[model samples]
Target: MAAFNLTPSDPSTFILNGIPGLEAAHIWISIPFSTFYVISLLGNFTILFVVSKEQTLHKPMFQLLCMLALTDIGMSSCVVPKALCIFWFRSKGITVDGCLTQLFFFNTAMTVESAILVTMAFDRYIAICDPLRYATILTNAQIAKLGLLGLIRAVLLVLPEPLLLRRLPFCPNRVIPHTYCEHMAVVKMSCGDTRVNRTYGLVTTFVVIMLDLTLIGLSYGLIIRAVLRISSKKAHRKALNTCTAHVCVMLMFYTPFLFSTLTHRYGQYIAAHVHILLANLYLLVPPMLNPIIYGVKTKELRDKVGKYTCRM
Candidate 1:
């Protein structure tokens, strides 16, 4: 155990546990995680390619979808391949700097995804509620600027995390009991006082993710109220239909996140494997499903995909 601790002469390295107690079954476990990784990679890449090429699909909603696809690709790329190396190749050694890099990118992608969803909700709000000004409001330039801001905000907010983490003194237990580097999971392994890490993590979640979710909820609230005033059921349905893909994505993103956070904080009585599994799912599920949800629900994307693939 002493060998794992940081000494004046020791190199900072971390051993990632593929599934802690389930090491013997890692070959089996990697199958599903790897399946989701491949699905998310191909699915999101297709969405990006399709939207970029289809002139008819050029709009605020589709633009936001592209941003989501980028984050999905990024987040999955940060964790998946290295995780496979651990599970399949039995190579779990990662430099502390390498682990921190993975953590930064993963968290940044998550924050940006949340912000993009909020922007998408706003886009839907205008298209459904204020059709006449939707163009003037979410112009291509404006949408591009919003997308850039989402990325900038995430980078700035998550930058401090790795820097702060680097300052901590890690104990001999340098083994992470999960596949990938998560913000809280890494901090929990430190022998140093983790109050700052945990508190800062909570504050950031509330400020960014919670606030984004709140705004998305408000946007939908207004959307529903506006949708309800229509005298015709057909109009109401049409207005609500535009938001179905985004709603499914929000559920896919938030449900796992909430469950993982709850398990991390309150599930001491729960098995470590359970917490680790939920944490992995929290990052994996959204990316894999977001593209499929949009591709299936949005007729424009679906037809464009079919058109593009048929040509190939």
Candidate 2:
């Protein structure tokens, strides 16, 4: 192999390690990963298509669901195909600019997804607690504004990452031990002082996760209080039932995300493959499961999906 003439200022390319200590198993790992990707594509696209065609489903809640589906598609698409290529073809080289682009889109999808979850929680809260005003508050115009704001917020939050990265001097060792261009993973390859990069990354994570979780929790707290005031047990069950899918989806997204984040930052004692696997799962599992959670818990969507499948 010829010597790699890499410059700290403008490194030509970085190699992605599919999974450290598991190179022999990359093909095996891609099996499940590819399965998840396919399921995510089918499930989320089905949600988008069904919701779009069904007139009765034209509402704030379903509109938000479509947004979530878009993000799910984006999140999985951002990483999975590239990962599959690495596993199957041993094609791991990624240019610095390409890596930065991937990092931006991946993080933007993640942040926007968080925002959408918070919006979904609020939607449930309003529908249950203030049914009369739900339509007024979450109007079509309002929903459009919310979606625009979410995209704007996501862009602003992630835009700094690529900019910060460009200024850094990367080390000669340009291999990242993961499937995709995760923000921190790319940052670690830099030989320059990375305090700003790390600090900003943590700040973005805190803003997206902690702030969103607090809002979701508050929405549910009010929802519970409102539900309790309903004297009938049947009414209580009915009110809570609507939120079950959202809650399940929330858990599916955050649990793995928190675990992966903490493990990456603090779990040095853990095995490398374990960290890589969880990181991949953090991106894969939620998208694959979100539509299924909604389909099983939501009667209208389920019926529509069944009818649509029968026609095809």
Candidate 3:
């Protein structure tokens, strides 16, 4: 047998381990994964189509919802196809460049989604707390600016991750034990010191999660206070009802996110397959659920979707 010649400096490809110890079940696993991907695509596209077509749904709230739907679609699309390929075809080999590209886009989508949620929270705050200035505060131009800012921020923050990974000399063991090239997993495969990589990753995670969640919480707190100030019970219900979809979406996004983040960092005792499974679910579940949540909770969107289905 010829001696292995690949070195740390010239590592070419990484093999993704899709749910280790469950190799026989991969094809079965692809069933639900593909199902979720289909649902996410159909649901989010329907939202975009409905929002664009309807005149009355063109408000600031729906505008932000459109942004959120776009982010969800991007986020799921970034990972699911490669994952399905892994599970169905056993095509787990990904070039270094390809893995880095996946890392950049996936992280970018996640960061942008967080920013979009924060913006949504702010929209709700303005609509309920200061209804008079909602129009002036979040004009079409302003919403466009906010969306652009989010994309820029996400790109800037995630750009460094892939660049940093590119500089690292990866070890010969290139098998990553997850469906996708998650930042920390790829970092762990590096032969060089990854202190900077780990530090920067943690710092960026904190910057995005801490800042965004704090702002969201503060917005909701003020929203609650304002709702309480409304003397009529009917007014209170009306104001809170508008926030239901957003609140549910936020919870769905953050709960799995925080879990996956914490487990990646500190869950040494946890099973690897469990961690990987949840990591996959973290990407899959939110996109699948966001449109459904909004469709059920928002009357205008629900009614339009009902009409569209009936026509179909």
Model-by-model lDDT, in order? Answer: 0.86, 0.91, 0.90
Give the runs in model 1 whose Cα sits over 4 Å from its true position: 1-10
**Mind giving the per-residue lDDT tens digits that candidate 2 earns over 1-312?**
122343333468888878999999999999999999999999999999999999999988889999999999999999999999889988887898999999999999988999999999989999998899988999877887898898999999999999999999999888899999998899889999999999998888987899999999999999999999999999999999999999999998898888887777788999989999989987889999999999999889999999999998
What is candidate 3's CA lDDT for residue 298? Answer: 89
Q: Per-residue lDDT for 1-312 in model 3, tens only?
A: 111333334467888878988889999999999998899999999999998988889887888889988989998888999999888777778889999999999999999999999999999999999989989999988988999999999999999999999999889888888999999999999989999999999999998999999999999999999999889999999999999989889998888888898899899999999999988988888898999999999898999988888998
Q: Where in model 2 is the C-alpha error above 4 Å?
A: 1-10
- Estimate candidate 1's alpha-carbon lDDT, on a 0 to 1 scale: 0.86
* Candidate 3 structure, TM-score to reference: 0.96
* Model 1: how far residue 277 lies from native, Å: 1.6
RMSD of each: 2.9, 2.3, 2.8
Model 2's alpha-carbon lDDT is 0.91
Give the Å error, residue 205, model 1.
Answer: 1.0
User: Residue pairs in steric clash, candidate 3?
Assistant: none
Q: Give the clash count for each candidate.
A: 0, 0, 0
Q: Indicate whether candidate 1 or candidate 2 has the larger lDDT.
A: 2
Clashing pairs in 1: none
